[model samples]
Target chain A: MVAAPCCAADDCIIEARGLTKEFSGFVAVCNVDLRVRRGHIHALIGPNGAGKTTFFNLLTKFLAPTRGQILYRGEDITHAKPAEVARRGLVRSFQLSAVFPHLTALENVRIALQRTHPGTFHFWKREATLAVLNDRARELLELVDLGAFAAVVAVELPYGRKRALEIATTLAMDPQLMLLDEPTQGMGHEDVDRVTALIKQAAAQRTVLMVEHNMHVVSRIADTITVLQRGQIIASGSYAEVARNPLVMEAYMGAPDGELRGGH
Target chain B: MRAQPVLYSLAVLFALAVPLLGIYPVFMMQLLCFAMFACAYNLLLGFGRMLSFGHAAFFGFAAYATGWLVSAHGWGPGFAILAGVAAAALLGLVIGALAIRRQGIYFAMITLALAQLVYFVCLEAPFTGGENGLQGIPRGTLFWLLPLHSDVVMYYVVLATFVAVFALIRRVVHSPFGQVLKAIRDNEPRAISLGYEINRYKLLAFVLSATLAGLAGSLKALVFGFVTLADVQQSTSGDVVLMTLLGGTGTFFGPVLGAGIVVTLQQYLSDVVGGWVTAIIGATFVACVLAFRRGIVGELTLLASRARRTLRPARG
Candidate 1:
């Protein structure tokens, strides 16, 4: 473990002490402690069932933790309603990049923007006629470099563009803390780089807690890395520190031999 | 776009002139009422992706409620109908809250089970006249005195309501909320990840659909002058599903087409085949599920789109 001193205030933004979630009789996520700071890109990397996604789910209030306390922005937010969590500005993205496929890309983001907007029920005008909402949606679309595909059905967009649109939809909520589960889970290397850059860009403004399998992506972009296996955070430090630890290598990171870390 | 609009205009024109065409106008009135009911049912099953077997609870409850108000208490037809709509929406709120906890096939089973409960209550309830229904349900008056007993006048009133509701359904479907409902249908978990409260949206849709269905049922009771037990039957619930599917899933006008087809089939099949409409309706449901999942309107929409694409001048 690299003995980098931890600043209590900066390090405790997402303090998870003994977080655990069990599905039926099986323990999908074991007792684990996780901490991520504001304005930092925190990557949670592990093999397929290393509990990274479960940990993220617990934080996002999608799944209630059987035993754990998840503190977001210094308040215990364990098991709050998903919308309440969203209203508090902690949002998530799915591995499959959940987007409204039938809707135009602009409409997808428009709905997202509507989720956070109070004036959403004005029925007289069409959604496209809602000038304020449309401009903001387009701005978010432009931010993701999907301005050209704004009018196209999301289903018609290529895979990489869909992922970008998902990011834009999440951004439309103006999330203070974003939880992304495998943002590049199914992307090619080129798409992975693009998504990683977007994540990095997003992290500059707020906080990003992501679950990644790719060591190279984590190593390249993560300001801090936490390795989990059997639900516990076995290793937590800078990428170099966690990447070097033998326990992390054996339990989580695989061989780091450049063949398949599952990382980009 | 042009073709669809023209087809829509023709449908509207036909709906307007049906009573004037002198083709047993009462049948047309019944057709309009059921068309609106089926459309309301489709609003959920087609777009919301929720198959409700208890929709009859709303339809029947509204029928009796509206019938009682207009016939026994001498309430205005419009006010009584509105009351029925509100009651069904409230019922939908309660039922939807419980039913949405489980999803897919379990949802269908739960709704069926709940509708059975409602059926039994109607069987014993005093206000429901204990399955005899609230009869002598005076067709009321156009404006409380104009007397809508004339078949043609009543038919046109039903016609106007049907057209308005159809337009309302169209407006809602193309709205932002409708898009969200479709998003939920295709991928609910994904919609949730996008910060949509899936259950809330679903409940709202269920209530809205039920309210509109109740509106149709209320109008139906007023048209026929009675609230029959047939309104709330499990078969009626299935009838709406069949209608929506035969018309088309997720297409705005498919349910209307399906409803018209089912009504016509019931009339003709009962008259010609005699004692076989049940078997035929069952067969039609199976065939639709197995082969014609897109129904008539859905197929037409697909054809229209294909034609539009082909008609496009070869892009350079």
Candidate 2:
């Protein structure tokens, strides 16, 4: 396989200005501004209640932003439905483990490929795109190193494998921007590092904005990091710079450098 | 070992055995109608994981449309069946588009309410022949003179329709579209994130299910030479769901077996228990729900999987 030509153009692929999300007087994300450039693996890190997931929901149109403007490729997408937003080359993975549990991993990828191309209502004649579809799905599964388990039911996979399959399935759509919520949520250190590497590989072709809590993983994979606290951006900078920020320290309960136990 | 061809042969042998056994043709025709109904209903429930509560709207509505087409305009049975199927497809399109606005229990309720509305429409429509229904209809031939009046021939006809529709469903469930429908059922959010227009797939599934149910109903009316308000009744809808669920929700051949069992049980119970048949069917539904959520086919498949594993060495 050829390497994806990395084109970190530094132009904002996703721009959020004054974004806010509230539910019945509870502010989940408040007045946050974020800019993610094309082909950059950006990470958002915060404490449990920092509203990273809420912000992701807003950006992907899973939930309505209380108030904000989300510009993707310089056009507004603040109010588009999830499908419409996805059709515009923006897709998101779920934080709480979203996947088709019954389908095989390869089948899952194939279905995603099928959805991307023509619909499945071809009532007569063989689907002309079958060979290409199968190959594309196979290529994605191999990228995630899930080629061995391609025919295994996704639900039957180990947690790490399932996470990898989730990422693989999303990547098969060839999105211009990928929003992943907690991609390494329950992974072991080795699995986390492996997935972080895989995420970097995927980011070679498109922009990747991820939500995470592991500082070391963030440091290794993210070109830039945003720290949020109480639904607000507390700090934003390079990994080394954010590590020294006093606000980042305070947000991590006064632990210097915002490092957690069991972190490499 | 390789049991697929043997199983296929067995199924074919059994289907062909119906005529040789000297069975009553009308009884087989009734079974065939319900079989198609269960299979079409199962297309959504088994594969789509959507248990529709108002299938009668399609089944009975098509029956009425077919009755109207044949009696009012003196159309042939083939054209009547086509008109009924078209009407059912349109109904499925409208109802599926609306019902899919929500998922889970809400989807079922929305379909039921829409079916009730259809029931009310049938009640008021002048062509429906009111409560007495459109009776004295001719049991028209297939095309011109296939002579559908012979009981054995009509029985074979019904059987053929049942087999074709069932095979088509089997073909569909294994197809890419079916794979996506299953994926959507298992995880809607993941499917949408993967770029599926979730509602469109769902609506198309609904329409397909509705149209096939219509085909079965249209054929049933032709075989019996009568259509009535009972076809449009709410109970008719509930019966199809019960039939599918009782046989199996996830298995391909489950609905076929389910419809056969339920119809046979109805026939046997009518002879032994008379008016208490409905109560018996209701009791069966409750039993199946409580004890067999996987239904007969799913449970059998589960058992087969378990057996396969047991016969093999454990993998580390």
Candidate 3:
């Protein structure tokens, strides 16, 4: 195998160089180069079908890139399995809320933490052995403001709480770089604000690369913003700088004259 | 949940009383064997969400192995049964490694194809006796001391094995490993994102299920004193699937209940209706799929929960 060329600086937690994904004849993501610095809320924003999700998939190793490499802490992880990548402290949440529907909210988080304990593969061990993790799992649930609903089954929880549970489960993994795909996709204004604040709080000690359609959530929490148009990076900088770029405005609104709006 | 232990004790008492109640020991033993088989199958299909269409490959193969060891090689029943379980587990490892690469219908198809391959191998293999199968197998002494020649003795042994294996299955279902299996079953992609090596967990579940099924098959061979192509036939696979679905797929006691119903219908109805037992079973399975999609136990549990909810409206 050929060694990936090193391009990221020491502080860069993840770097994508010349990443391209082609499904059959059509290109989904094309030659995207990006870097996420440590402990920064980096948001990848774009209109529908602009390849933001595809790029995120490539970074998380959900989709193998056709061309180019992904480096985590300057180590090439382009061909790693999704679980292996996650085990290396790069966990991701889905566009849809992905809690185990039959499990309680606390049990859903406990599944993530169970791997850290012994006998995760021991069928002979009693499930009560996992009770040791309950305190810690409850702590994580409380972290996401789901403390009261810990005993509730995940499917019974309301829409936004399910997303909160997903985040809580993701947090249980203790990832260094968390990839969230549209954390606030379908929510009321109140839920969107709560999740936005939750995301900001989650990004306190880790790097977050998120694909967000909601510009308000992006403008509020995203420290750095990368805008994609037709699978190519149109602008990459602070949210204010990317919002002021004319190409991003044209991509969002189809008119080059207007400024990129933050709310809604 | 609090009523579970009492229910279990009553079930054990009933099983014990069945022999003293003048029911044929051999028939009850057969029911217990099939019940064990269904429980093992449930661990995969109900809990792991893996539909294996070729479980008879393990079931029939283990029976043949035990029959050959006891009749041809003069092996003790215990060693023969252990060897049979080992053979089935080995087959499970090979099949699971290949089949888990796909999902849904493809996975089921792969298992079916591999099981057909095993069936053909058994048919053509020299020691399997092809059409005649391994017949006139001895009941031989258990551990070369405790005689299994008596029907009543063998019945107790089978019941004990059934009870132990059932408890083991329950233990496996409630364990941390079982929790992970449930998570994988519920959502594979999310489990993957959570850093679970899901394929390994799935493969382990398959092998364990297969091993337990083999235990049932080996026990059945000892009870019948013969191993035939019928044990490994495609219809046997279908019968297990029908039994599991008729009882309940995911519930712990569902498969056992299903196996009991199917086995009883086969034993008693065969004498009355002859070959129409097959047609009756088929119709029952169809009715089960249509009327109670959750299977008997699953629907009952739902109703009981609903009843409790109605009774305790103040809690809400």
Candidate 4:
């Protein structure tokens, strides 16, 4: 492991330099340098095809970059495996609800918590040994207000509840940096509100970098917002600053005359 | 759910009494061996969600290894069988390493192709007796005391082996590691993001399955007093897959039940129909897939769970 460079601005927990991803001749994420500070809610908002997901994947090492380097806590992790990156605490909660459908909601959280437990390979021990994690799993379930549905299979969960379960499972990882990709992609108003609150609670103790289309959600919790259009960062600042930027407004509404709607 | 332990105990008692109850000892032994094989296969296909088409390589090669050792080297049956299991595990590591690089149908095809390679190797190998196979292999005494020369004695030994391995598998399926395998099977990307080395878990599950399958094969060799190329054939691989699907993929008893039904069907059908036996089995599989997609045991479990849910009042 290469030692991270000592810099005065060490609050930048994740730093990407010249990060680029290309598909054939088309560049999906072009020459992006991003620095996410510690313990802040950072939002990556963009119109469709803005490559927010691609950049997220690049940071999490789900997809290798065609060029550039990713440094986590100053350590170069551009070549780390997804699992390896997760092990180092930069975990990702995927779009389309990443919870295991067949497992019970409690089991889903317990499985995530099992990663921190020793003897994860102990196949001979009575399953009662794992009952010890039930309380913690239950706590996480209650944290997401799904405590009553602990026994319900994940697949049977309501859409909003499933996203909450996903966040609960993500929280069980106790990650230093959590990447949530479109956590509220297909939800009604009620679910969106519940999940937005859940994400805020989940982000309380960690750094969060989320890709969201709902400007309301981005404005509500984001300390910093980066607006991207056509694979390039058009504006990066406080939510108010980015929301007022003419370029960011043009990127969202397409023309000068259209009002910048909060929900998309 | 509360009655499960009693049901399992009753099942165990029934299995133990099979030899004493005047059931055909040889036939029962064969059933037990195949049931174990199905259970082993279930460990991968059912739990790990890995479909291997070349499982016969492990099953048949172990038989050959045990038969070669006991007949040629004069090793005791107990030690010879252990050697067979070891050989299968070694083969599993090699095959699993290559097979797991791909997913879904590709994994199945790789295993199938590799098993065919084992089949041809068996056909050409000197000690395996090629087409004739190794015959008249001794049913050496278990632990140098319990004479396996008698079919009744051998039946008990095979039954005991099956029970022990089955229990071990049950333990594995309920263990935390097993839970992780289920998580991986349900959603692999999420499992990886949870910091699981999924391929390692998959490889381990594959090896365990192969080792248990080897155990079944070695026992079959001892009971039948022969090791045949038929055991290593692609058809045998297909048979286990059929049995697993027929019984249930992920359920604990599905594979065993499926194996029992398939082996019984084959035994009876071949006597009268001979050439038509394969077609009949194929038809049965189609019926099962169409109507019982969850497999026999899986559907039964679902029914049982539903019954329990209905009978019990809702709780907070």
Candidate 5:
């Protein structure tokens, strides 16, 4: 495991060194080293099949790496379970919206907050005791602009609203580093703008690492952007710096040289 | 749905009046035992989304344990029943740990396979009396106070226990643990991502469900004065599954109504149909599954909600 040379141990919330994942003989994610700085909206952008999601899964410990080291807050966590990593405040949201569809919007957030309660695993205790969490749960709903729809079941929510609710549930975990997988995927312009702004607000105190397909959202919010193609990092810098790079332009627009512009 | 309280009270009143109306107390006790079994099964299959096909192992094992304790060892009914429940819980812990490693149909198959192993043990064990079963299980006094020799007294005892167990199941269904179970059922990956170790929850539900099913078995052994091979048979597990599904899988009172219908059908139809009773019950289950995909209670709840929606506009 190589220690990050440029940044101090405390400066990075999570660091990956020599991360690799293989399915049979197919290499999904090759040896890659990356650092997510504390309190920054770091966006990982890649073309289709560029191994961005695979890298995210490896970091979350959902899929064990073929060979690599993952450090969370300078501690080796390559062998941690997904839930264990989550409890340590490294949380993730799926590419698809991950709200509990049958539960109400308020209940969705409450489930995330329930881990802190003493009686979370008490099967015999009355569920009414969880009413204490309702106030904080509602506050989270309001944070995502879902206060009015608190009583509505998640299944009935609009697609973009469901994404917002997913974010609300993620926020309820109070994660130190939030890994959002395509937070604005399959959204209308209005919804995307709203969610992009929501992510900015959510990242005020916490660090965020997101895999995004929308160039506009990434350019607007991402402090540092990394471009990946064919299972390897092709370029890493600010949006403008990476956007102008000839390789990134070629990977994105299939052109040898051009300025990367707007949503893909 | 709003009429639930009234409906429940009426049902309880009917149950109380059954013996007075000269409808055999023994039959009613049997019905209550099966109802408890179905409710316990529903706790796992309905709420936890675990379809355990080997629940008969717990049920039958407990009946034999309780029977041996009460008849041979002359143990009190209370202690024997508790012992039976504990034995079932231990078996559940072992089976659940293994079964939970697989999901969906594989999990069901594991339970069925394990329960069959228990069945063969019962079939060959010296204590189970092989094919004849452990007969003449005496229903001892309750806490050494009230004699359970009379069918009427025993009926009331079974009724009280059924009510208490039913209430406990209700409490469990609505608890914070139940909330997490539902979350796991709805979306397991999301639940895991939220930091829940879902396997532990599933195992606990399994053990609790098995213990309650064992309670029903122990009660049946005491009431019937025999522990039969029928108790541990695979059909017994299928019967409870049918009862839960026919009544409604997830609804609170669905399994109870399902058990009532099934038990009543078996009791009344056996006189007329004789050897065809099983065939008739099978046909009825098929018809119910085809007609009510959500089960009787679930369909009723849906219709009630639709009616409420139409009525709200009229009220305005």
Candidate 6:
């Protein structure tokens, strides 16, 4: 029950001190000391099996870290439930389970707003009370450029629109720090651009820590970048600095033999 | 949607005319009780997406409670029924807490095992009468004022209770909490990440479903003047599942229709085919699964929407 040591820097919203996760004998995330500055877009990029998702899971409390502590806003939330962490305004948009498919885009966002609403437990209240949230849900949908699909079920929307709807739902939670895992995975060039724009707009008012395979989107939007290899942080600095780092180049291209290309 | 109210009114009018046409009132009462049981099961299966194989634990336990109060303690029908419902809801809370720890098929299996445990408890318990059950329980008047000695009066009372409970179920389905329940059903992880303590919502829905099932069970005890171990048996649980699946899992009128069809088939089939009644029901369930996976009402909705689509003029 000891409190985690807080960072002296006032801008550090999230600090992970030697966070490690092991499944049986093999380590998935190893002693990764990390700091995420407030109101900055932080990107965690790694090759396949580098444990970016495993690390994200630990920070979100979806999985208990095998070792070390996680500090959120200077408070130790290492043992909190996903819902408890979310209630404190640190929320996550999952890979696939980020949106309710059967619910319409508007209804999906409405449920997020309803979570923080006082009348969530009022089963007997008139539907009018719920109708009052429609305007705000629609506003979020518009923000994600999903205004036309407001009435469509999340499942019926195209893959990119589904991703947009997920973002809208996450935005409805009004989170202080939004953790997005693979925000642009499996997308066409157009969708990747659209989601990249959405992420940039979202990061304006809140901190975002995203794990992305598409380094182009990350380089464009991320203010700070942390690169991992073999479950260990290889480099941590500004996006330009991480991109130019020889270690990161070696991890992505098998060896640091040539200059980095194509991602720009 | 516009045709819904007209359809509902017609159905109510038909229910009223059944007893007057000299149809057996007791048979109709059984249908009402079973219909309510299926609706309660449907609440968990259709909306919550949590299949509970042990719902008979709630229905059967309440029947025994009502039977004991009326026959042994001389309690009035209203108070006895209320007490039975409260006990069943408490049981639901305990069972739901345990069962919700698992997901999918495991949840169903856990509920089934717990229900079997309850069955054994009823078999060994003293006041349940084990094999004999509580027999010849009196159907006391409502509030001790209206006389329920007449079959016609009892028919009206059961019908009234059925309608009130049906309205309650309808209210819950359309409410905001119901929206949250549907969201949980569609995706549990998303609901949790949205900051909903989904286990609480699941348990609340379970308690409400159990309470309604209890109401149906208590009513059945008064109507038949008996409670048997058969009421709480695993077979009874299967019957409710069959009725719900046959009617349509998520539709409003599906369970009622399924209950009516199953109850009538059982009654007349037992008179003629005797031991083949189970076989006949088994065949019907197989047919339902193979030919009409969406059940009766679900098919009707599909057809209606199709018809509307065809009737509309094609846009240029």
Structural similarity to truth (TM-score) of each candidate: 0.93, 0.93, 0.97, 0.96, 0.96, 0.95
DockQ of each: 0.41, 0.50, 0.86, 0.81, 0.75, 0.68
Instruction: Enumerate residue pairs that collide in model 2.
Output: none
TM-score of chain A of 1: 0.89
Off by over 4 Å in 5: A1-8, A257-259
Please give, for residues A185-260, the per-residue lDDT of candidate 2 as tens digits.
8888778888889998899989999998777788788999999888999899889888878778777866555443
User: Just chain B of model 2: what TM-score?
Assistant: 0.95
Better of 1 and 3 by lDDT: 3
For each of the candidates, the C-alpha root-mean-square deviation to the true structure, in angstroms, is: 3.3, 4.0, 1.8, 2.1, 1.9, 2.0
Candidate lDDT (C-alpha), each: 0.82, 0.84, 0.92, 0.90, 0.93, 0.89
Q: Better model by lDDT, 5 or 6?
A: 5
| Candidate 1 local lDDT, A1-264, one digit each (tens) | 222233236664677768888989889888887778878888887777878777777887888989977777767777677767787788888887678888889988887777666634433345554456888989999998998988999998999999999999888888888888888877788998898899989888888888877777887788898878887777889887776777776764355443324344
If you assessed candidate 2 against the hidden native complex, which CAPRI class would it receive? Answer: medium
DockQ of 4: 0.81
RMSD (Cα, Å) of candidate 6?
2.0
The DockQ-based CAPRI class assigned to model 6 is: medium
The TM-score of the first chain in every model comes to: 0.89, 0.90, 0.96, 0.94, 0.97, 0.94
Docking class for model 4 is: high
By DockQ, the candidates rank as 3, 4, 5, 6, 2, 1
RMSD (CA, Å), candidate 2 to true, equals 4.0
- Cα displacement (Å) at residue B74, model 1: 3.3
Chain B TM-score, model 5, reads 0.98
Give the per-residue lDDT digits (tens) of candidate 4, residues B1-316. 6777998899889988887798899999999999999999999999899999999999999999999999999999999999999999999999999999899999999999888888989999888998899999999787779999999888888888898999999999899888998999999999999999889999989999999999999999999999999999989999999999999999888898899999998998899999899999999999999999999888988899887788778652
Candidate 3, DockQ to 2 decimals?
A: 0.86
Candidate 5 lDDT over B196-304, as tens digits, reads 9989989999999999999999999999999999999999999999999999998888999999999998999899889799998899899988999789999999999
Q: Write the per-residue lDDT of candidate 3 for residues B1-316, one digit (tens) a residue.
A: 6677898899999889887899999999999999999999999999999999999999999999999999999999999999999999999999999999999999999999999999999999999999999888999899967799998889989999999999999999999999999999999999999989899999999999999999999999999999999999888999899989999999988998999999999989999999999899999999999999999999998898888888897776
Q: Can you write out model 2's per-residue Cα lDDT over B1-316, one digit (the tens) per residue?
A: 3665687679877767877887777888898898899999998988887778899999989999998888888998888899999999999999999999988899999999999999888888999988888786676787896677787878877888888897888777776677778888899887777767788888878999999999998988887888887887889888888888888887777787888888898888899999899998999999999998888887887888888888776653
- Computed on C-alpha atoms, the DockQ of candidate 1 is 0.41
